[model samples]
Target: MYLGVLALTAFVLTVFLLVYLGLFLGRLPFLQLDRTGVVLLGAIALVATEVVPLSGIGEVVHLPTLALLFAFMVISAQLRLGGFYDWVVVWLDRRALAPPVLLGAVIAVAAALSAVFSNDIVCLAMAPVLAQLCRARGYAPLPHLLALACAANLGSALTLIGNPQNMLIGEVLRLDFGDYLRVAALPVLLGLLSTWVIIAGLSRGHWLEASASLLPSALGRAGEVGVPLDRWQTFKGLTVAALLCAAFLWAHWPRDLLALAGAGLLLTSRRLHSRQMLGLVDWQLLVLFVGLFIVNHAMQQTGLPAQAVAVLADEGLDLQEPAPLFAASVLLSNLVSNVPAVMLLLPVAQAPVDGPLLALSSTLAGNLLLISSIANLIVVQAAARQGVVIDWRAHARVGLPVTLVSLVIAAAALLPWRA
Candidate 1:
């Protein structure tokens, strides 16, 4: 028994190190493997080594989280194919609003959309539209683009369906959807407002000046040509989204079932082909979650994580406590991405506040640095394609303050509830 325990411990630690190394580096050095590839490889290695038996894979993978994520991706794809997001951008552009007011509007729209759809998808769809609009109007695009990413991250914390990590927390903890929203709504709103102030304040005089030359190829002629709205398809997608939200907030239906039904409804459309909708789904992300679920569950079986939690408790830093859990959530989130961070912390979650604390802290921490969230990188890469660069320093100027202020607000709000 002792030898078996020792071997399992060694194996778990080795795999954990290798997997997180790829996570922190964003890719394997001198290899083409990205973070998703790295985690998938780790899971495969564990199975191949029989560290986790092939038969046990089913038990390790969490189907509800995957189902919810897949359903939402399908819904987001429908909205994208229907040009709902593009219509939103075009509508905003046509409105005669000043820079600051426009910034606020962008933040609000991005946050609200992200609160329902995938935040990465929200940034992916909106960034190019926003960039082109800013350039056409002779204004800087960086601040607006950054605000979109930050607000998406903040807004995603507002509800269980907001992001992948939040969904996992809600599912694992069996949290009341309405209860989580009630606790999280104020913090998310305050965070969005803070995001606008920081970005607008930092970009005050620069909003009118063109900051970078637009690359014609990067800003494709088709992109600037404007996407025509298919109002009927858009309305169909919106109605399904509304119904799903209503189910989550009021009805006692299984969230995965409701979400999957909504996705199915969108897929049966005449104009939008299944191929086009499926093409927009992030299969890679779903695979990443599956891989991490197996890998983390295997690690948990070794009992090291539980032991570590007990040790920390002895040291007066109980993870079951709200404050320490919040701190750990922020630290781990910035180190690894929020999904993996939340997966690691989920086993220790017990308090009623743990669900919201993990959800809010992991999400808010995503705004702390450029590399902290995929949403930030998506916006930056999209901007870079248009010859507008947002480096670490530029992101930190806004991101650091927004993260600090938002976290402080979250802590003040949640900690008191614990008391």
Candidate 2:
């Protein structure tokens, strides 16, 4: 019986490591799969191996995380389909702002919207439009797109509902909505400023060029139809978003329920079909979350995590400590992505400080490496579709400095709070 437990532990550990390896490399060696597909496969392997029984799947996955993620998707989809995002990009571009000034504006707007809405959705909606706007003006699109990716990440740290991992952290830790803002606002603002500065400084001379890689002249950059702005639909989306924010800040009820209710209300719109709203929800990301949750829960049941924590503590590396927790959050986030990292370390999160520490570190860490954040991937992929290439080197040139500066600011901001 004891040997059976050991065998289970070893098998689960191997699966966990392999899953994270696939995530870090963005694919498994012989398999053509994305991050989502890799995790999904790992989850199936766990269930099939009976390391986690099929009947126990429901108990492992966090329903609230799924609820909040899906609901936010619907909200963001409503706003995007209303052409709110397109209008904002066109308006920003029409200002005739100088290149440096325009970069700052893009960063600020992306960060602010992401703080209220969802970061991935903000990037998903804004990246292509920003690319088109830049390309139309004979400007390079990489800097602006990088700003969108980095700032959206930094901004998402400000509010619990801003991103998926933040939502999970908030729900699991039960951090107060208002209090998190109060603590996170200053750091996030500073980080956004830092992001703008670094990206602007790095891309200074290149901004005006048609780009190093010229597009095929025959390609239709001129008359690509934009999502038309519908004022009434925009108003409906904005109204729901505003009320949801108010409820999140003031109401003490379960946030997932409130968000899901808001999504349900939006689906009842006379014009926007329920299918359309539901269609925009990132079923892939939701599936990824469900897979990771199941796999991690099965790993936790083996008691390996606690044992590892004990071993690390004996070496004076206590994960429950704030400083160590912060470092671990960043490292693990970079290694396996933020959501999985948080789920793995959540057991050792001992205080309210751990919550903020975990949330900020993990979110900020996304900016350091291109593959670390889904928002970064979305922005990069969106740009590619627009014939604007933003490779890892281009991103890291600004991303590394921006991440370092932002993390320092966050650590300093939380210093007094820790005391």
Best by TM-score: 1
User: What lDDT score is found at residue 107 in candidate 1?
Assistant: 93
Show where candidate 1 strays beyond 4 Å: 210-223
lDDT of 2 by residue, 357-400 (tens): 88999999999999889899999999999988888898889889
Model 1 lDDT tens row, 1-419:
99987988798789988998899889888889999999999999889988889998878888888899999999888778778888787778777567788799999999999999989999998898888888777777888898999999999999999999999999888898999999999988988888888888888778775554432222323546345567888888888999899889899988988898888988898888899989988989988998898789888888889999999999999998888899999999998899999999999887788889999999999999999999999999999988899999999999999999999999988967686
| TM-scores vs. true structure, each candidate | 0.95, 0.94
Location of the lowest summed lDDT over 10 successive residues in candidate 1: 212-221
What is model 2's C-alpha RMSD? Answer: 3.0
- Clash count for each candidate, listed in order shown: 0, 0
